[model samples]
Target chain A: MNYIEHTGKYFAMLKQIFRKPQKWIIFKESLFREMEDIGINSIGITAFISFFVGGVVVIQMALNLENPFIPRYLIGYATRMSLVLEFSPTLMSIILAGKVGSYITSSIGTMRVTEQIDALEVMGVNSLNYLVLPKIIASVVFYPLLVTLGIFLGIYGGMVAGVLTDLISMPDYITGLRTDLDPFHFTYSMIKTVVFAFVIATIPAYHGYYVHGGSLEVGRAGTKAVVWTSVVIIVLNYFLTQMLLS
Target chain B: MIEVKNIYKGFNGVEILKDVSAVFENGKTSLIIGQSGSGKTVFLKCLLGLFETEKGIISFDGRNYAELGIKVRRKLREEIGMVFQGSALYDSLTVEQNVMFPIKMFKNSSQKEMLIRVNEVLERVNLEKSNKKYPSELSGGMKKRVAIARAIVMNPKYLFCDEPNSGLDPQTSTLIDNLIHEITVENNITTIINSHDMNSVMEIGDKIILLKDGYKVWDGTKDEVFYTDNEAVTSFVYSSNLFKKVREVYTGNIKL
Candidate 1:
């Protein structure tokens, strides 16, 4: 489809998802389940990736700032900036775009091919509202929480990595973390996280909800969902950064 | 009664259903028998309002579906139930939960009331003991039974089944067919089944509509199927030697 067609369909799908659910109680129930699926279930991988990347960034900073005139605390400062300003919000989202995106696409695509969605529609249920709305709401609410947790873990990991490696003393790292800490940078990252979260939820859902074939097609849709979600997140990250931080 | 009048449906200008019409009666098992690409599914979907007909009217109980307001259309949908070919049971929900879904969505029943109704339907489908099992754990026949139970949980006025016995053995297929027929009669539902299964056609086909190449070639009862001379119906109904033999026995051409 061309850009206009795809955009129109996407917005149409968005409009459909906003329709009142068949049952509010059922919608609430699904919302909690999705929150668990998209948020709670994702903590382990997010924490692991965030901690390691945080440590790696600190190590890289230590190596690059080998000049005798440069202070050792700059390693901590650089690590803080990277994790809060970019890594926690953007990189973590790209990862989630892969993990959550595939799950949404395959699950909904499977439902489409298996005729479950048709069953819903035949029963007077708005299938899009019943299926996709919960996920979108869950992601929009919980993704920022996950990113916040990621930011904390990543900075702690940086502190641990720098102090253990003896490249920087604990007091010096703490001082660097406290010095010149702009609260706006944290807010800027949170804004990026919210936008990326919306993209991660909706784009994959769009792919999965409209997928028209069997298992092979569902698989292909999943791959396309992940790729598209990541690309959209990156592009949006650029625009959001420009608009919010520039 | 569900009355379809000259419905025309197509995709991208290529017609899949052309000027097809039929009346599916209440309290009877109506089967739409056709070959692959005979527009049986398309016709069924159109009847279910999953696909829109470009031209024609589908009226339920004398009310034109297309002309109904949005609220009325949805109310009409709530009165309808469907059993898909694949069973289409939610993979994540247990059998009991699956059966309870419609009730929970449409009715303001308490959990206890919902469970009671769910167990009642599960028992009706002979699946009372499998409440906690997931769809993945059920056999093909069991899955179809669960689908049936879920479909009838709402006690809907109209029931539509798309290839309900598609992947089951002969005995299981017979069981599913009998169960659907029994339910239709018990609830006085206007049941429409799309099938190419001759066993199903002979066993429970109270009224049969035969379609070929997007047209309704012939329609009649099971007894009439043995007597009809319509080539499209004959060629399809007697395609297999076993069915041909059965037809002969019915016609007394050869004694059993």
Candidate 2:
């Protein structure tokens, strides 16, 4: 489909997601299952990426500040800004768009291909509500916590870099973290994360749930899910930064 | 009973089911038999409400499906149990959980009651001890049995089986056919089976519709197959040499 048609269908799918579930208790069961699948299974990767990326940002900043007049404490300040303003929210969400995003698409796409959705439809089980709502709720609930963890690990990794490499001291890093803490920056980051969480859940679901054909289409759906989610995340990151941080 | 009148279904302006009408009565197996592209699946999907037809009146138990609201449609949905061609049991759930799924979704029964119902259907399908096993752990025939058990666990009044014997050996195919037939009779479900399996048709088809190129060309029982001169029905049923020999013997055209 063209861009307009795709956007229209995406909104249409979201509209159906809000329809009443076939049963709340059964939906509750799916919610917990998907919570574990999206949140618990994802923390390790989120943490690993957050820590390493934080260290890299510190190193990059130190290398760029060749001027002798610049203070070493600025490295920590920049790291804090980068983590809270960008890396922890935006980068972590992009990573999730690849990791959790592909998973949701592939699993749902496989179900669609195998006639499992058809089975649910015949049973009068509102397949969209049964499939997508739980994943959306799980991601919305837990992804911000993941981003919060990302923020913590990011700063901690920067501190480790500072202490080990002598670019800045732990005291200086701690001071920078506390010096210019704008509460709105954290709120803005969360607002972005919440939006990202919804994108991560629903975009992939749209690709997967509407997929036609067999296993090949399912695989294509997964690939397309990752691509579309990454694009949407990046585009939304830009717009959200403009709207909120400006 | 279900009555379909002048049903028309299409995709991208290409008609797949054209003016098809038939009556599927309770306590009998109604078979929709056609070639791969003859739109039997489309017709079945229309009956199941999975596909919306451009024009048709499908009356299930004297209520028009298209006229009903979502609430009433859902109420009717609880009475439908479908056995998919791929035996589409949830891969994540165990056999028992798969069987219990519909019961849990449609009824407000407690755990004890649901488990009892699950086990009862499993036993009816002769799959008592396989509850803990997953779909991947079951053989093809065993998977079909489990699908049947899952379909019937809710005691649905209308049962739909789509190509139930597609991937089974001949003996196992007969077993699946007989199991569905016996359950349909015992429970008095309005069973509609879409199959290419002529063996299933001859063995259990109480009423059958033959379709070709998006139109219903013939409708009758197994006994009528032996006497009918309709080329579409005969060519489809006697497409095999074995069936040809059996037909010749039955009609006294050749000595055995």
What are the lDDT scores of the predictions, listed in order? 0.93, 0.91
Q: lDDT tens string, model 2, B142-177?
A: 999999998888889999999999989999999999
Tell me the DockQ of each model, to 2 decimals. Answer: 0.87, 0.85
Q: Tell me, by DockQ, which candidate is best.
A: 1
Collision count for each candidate, in order: 0, 0
Q: Name the docking class for model 1.
A: high
lDDT of 1 by residue, A111-212 (tens): 999999999999889899999999999998998899989988998888888889887889878777887999999999888998898899999999999999
Candidate 1's TM-score: 0.98
What is the DockQ of the complex in model 1? 0.87
| Model 2 TM-score (2 dp) | 0.98
Q: Every prediction's TM-score for the first chain? A: 0.98, 0.97
Candidate 1 chain B: minimum summed lDDT over ten consecutive residues — where? B69-78
> Candidate 1's residue-wise lDDT over B66-178, tens digit each?
99887788888889989999999999999999999988998999999999999999999999899999999999999999999999999999999999999999999999999
| Top-lDDT candidate index | 1
